[model samples]
Target chain A: MFERVLIVEDHESVSNSVKQALNDLGVDNPEHVSYCDYALSWIKKAIVTPQPYDLLITDLSFEEDQTVQQITDGVALIRAVREVQPDLKILVFTAEGRLEVIRPLIEKLGINAYVRKARRDTQELKAAFEAIANGRNYFPLQMKRSERNGHSFNFSTYDITIIRLLAEGKKQKDIPQCLQDNKITPSSLSSLEKRLNQIKDEFSFTTNEQLIAYCKDFKII
Target chain B: MFERVLIVEDHESVSNSVKQALNDLGVDNPEHVSYCDYALSWIKKAIVTPQPYDLLITDLSFEEDQTVQQITDGVALIRAVREVQPDLKILVFTAEGRLEVIRPLIEKLGINAYVRKARRDTQELKAAFEAIANGRNYFPLQMKRSERNGHSFNFSTYDITIIRLLAEGKKQKDIPQCLQDNKITPSSLSSLEKRLNQIKDEFSFTTNEQLIAYCKDFKII
Candidate 1:
């Protein structure tokens, strides 16, 4: 069990429900901070005495809309808390499902675990806690980035144009004309097709057709 | 074509091959660095001026294995670069395919693109560049954190036990006794069933029987 847990969330209902859930699961001494400044105060207090929480459960969004500190976002707050104690275990239990939010926190904040609020059931939280305590990492659900934007993975700008043109039903020969107008040569076009096929294989898709469809469905366009 | 490119690769042959590819594509102003210090030097220079490169292509591992600089690792490098220049385009062009590597990088680094070197085809790089320029992000192929560990997505620790026991043909009533003896309780069991249903929706398994097969195929036991 986490010796000292701090909950940094703005939603009173979700925070209270979490407290109740922890009690039901037999976790006591869990502290709660509903705002970033208060959390900062806690961080300052923890620095000298190391009241630095053993495990920090935080929602990614603490935007405080209509409040004074509306500019402070989730990633910035996480970084502030991190500056005080670099070794803290942070479990981002938030609703922000975008990789733009999730990935940067993982990269910048040194997050120990990721739990999506919408998809995760009760026991998954316990699993996340246990894993973080034991020095393992966890990511509950990942909605791929490309799907949201229908973008191709590791693709060049020309490749994007080609994919779009291809999706619009242009012939491969017609693609070279579009490319030649844009400075790509016939040899470059051949190399491009071969490489696109290879990238397609890495994604486990049968053809460029399947890849484009998956990308579009995910909104990676 | 990229006006000024920065390459953060360790291997000479691979870097040169990629450089050749870039040259073939008419991008000739690439600044190549096999070490972190040199890369950081270029980074400082880029910040001082506009940039030596418009895009940065980096590998996760570096040669000489620079000591104590966060720039030694690809994730750390992305973080540092992002801290200094929040909008620099970073394309991870590497072979580090693990989710622990890929997921965190995607989550934290805010990397604009990813292309596994071993998996690269001529067209994929082109595609990645195009996507990034058009303000899109890319991830190397995604692997669920649970799947890599041979665990079922919906199964908590008790669910795993129950699944294993069921797979071994244990009776339903006997299962509760088995769990009870092991400190797993009723609410946990209910939550487990609830979670299974959620996963059922996610993977379109439709039936409990199919869920069991999925668990088996994933080697949950």
Candidate 2:
């Protein structure tokens, strides 16, 4: 029953659907903007007014356009908005499925709900809205399952650093120099070899190529 | 309006939305399946019956589960269905936004229409159905624009081959041996160096790393 809602999304179709969902939920005339900057300004302007938006529904990636924008994406916009309105209920509606990308949003940004823009999204959106209205956080079931499975093999920053270097086409021998340059500890050849071997064993990967491919496929790198 | 519609999507929310859209369009009792194998069986069985599904609405990716499936993904399912029912209209309803992945479904598979699973997708799905029912093709507006912009810099097979190797951490000089093993012409170190330089110059990339990163970002390699 959140009456005042603001939508930040680039796609007209998506925004239209969100509006329709809000209307169906008895939340009338929810305001919407295609750009993050405009969304910010509206939120800022509404803060001084008697009527303020209590909820924000946003998409993560916005298609780049002719207009130059300081706040180009939803993550930045969310961060900025949190500074101004600390108590606003925020929901992310996006097509992004990567756990690596989404984990930080919930852990760091403290979003109230995340409903992926997929089939039966209207239902999902409504469910998320209901949860948020009742002061409960809503996360998709699949994400929870992924989190449980993903916890089995934890990827440390050091692991990501080495894997990212390998993905960037650096050979095993060349990684030590890059790591040393970055002032990362234990940059010796033997240490790097040991770490790579340990990681590969954990993942049951035979070679660096498989490990790199797996990382890329999972968006870990 | 198309009467008999078969929706092949793993996510219950998405399938429900598609059903809702189809119901709104006056197409009642549309069959739904969570697996591609089941979808194919349904289609195959219906083919012998008086009423076969006229349209196949499917998503590209399916969550892997305990059930073993021969036609694991939608692309394989599409290809399999094409063999049995060539005239049945196929509309790809997927979250995939990559031009490379979508282009093939249009050009090679000759799918009747494509509706991305996004905000306002119900509207788009209906619109796509209408177009396909009228014997026309439907491609998203952004996709058409991307096609126009994408035509400028074509990534040939040779370009992709070299870039993929580079992404796998192959050095420039080391590429000659890989090319030679594959019996690819111009396997000499000088030829590879020349090709790499030429491609970088076309894209205005100062280094191979930039070229590799660009290819990865755009899913060219």
The residue-by-residue lDDT of candidate 2 on A94-204, one tens digit each, is: 877667677788899898999876545778999999999999999978776566656367788999998787766676788899999999978999999999899978877
Number of backbone clashes in candidate 1: 32
Q: Give the per-residue lDDT digits (tens) of candidate 1, residues A41-116.
A: 7867876884556778877666333357632655777788787888888887765566755777778678888876
- TM-score per model (chain B): 0.60, 0.87
Worst 10 residues of 1 chain A by lDDT: A143-152
Separately for all candidates shown, the number of backbone clashes (residues 3 or more apart, or on different chains) is 32, 5
DockQ of each: 0.01, 0.20
Q: What is the TM-score (0 to 1) of candidate 1?
A: 0.34
| Alpha-carbon TM-score of each model against the true structure | 0.34, 0.72
True contacts kept of each: 0.00, 0.14
Which stretches of candidate 2 lie above 4 Å from their native place?
A: A10-34, A45-51, A65-70, A97-104, A116-127, A139-221, B10-17, B61-69, B94-103, B115-124, B139-144, B151-153, B171-191
- Listed for every candidate in order, the interface RMSD values in angstroms are 23.1, 6.0
Instruction: Tell how far residue A103 is off in model 2, in angstroms.
Output: 4.5
Evaluated on CA atoms against the true complex, candidate 1 attains a DockQ of 0.01
**Candidate 1 residue runs with Cα over 4 Å from true position:** A63-66, A141-150, A153-221, B1-221
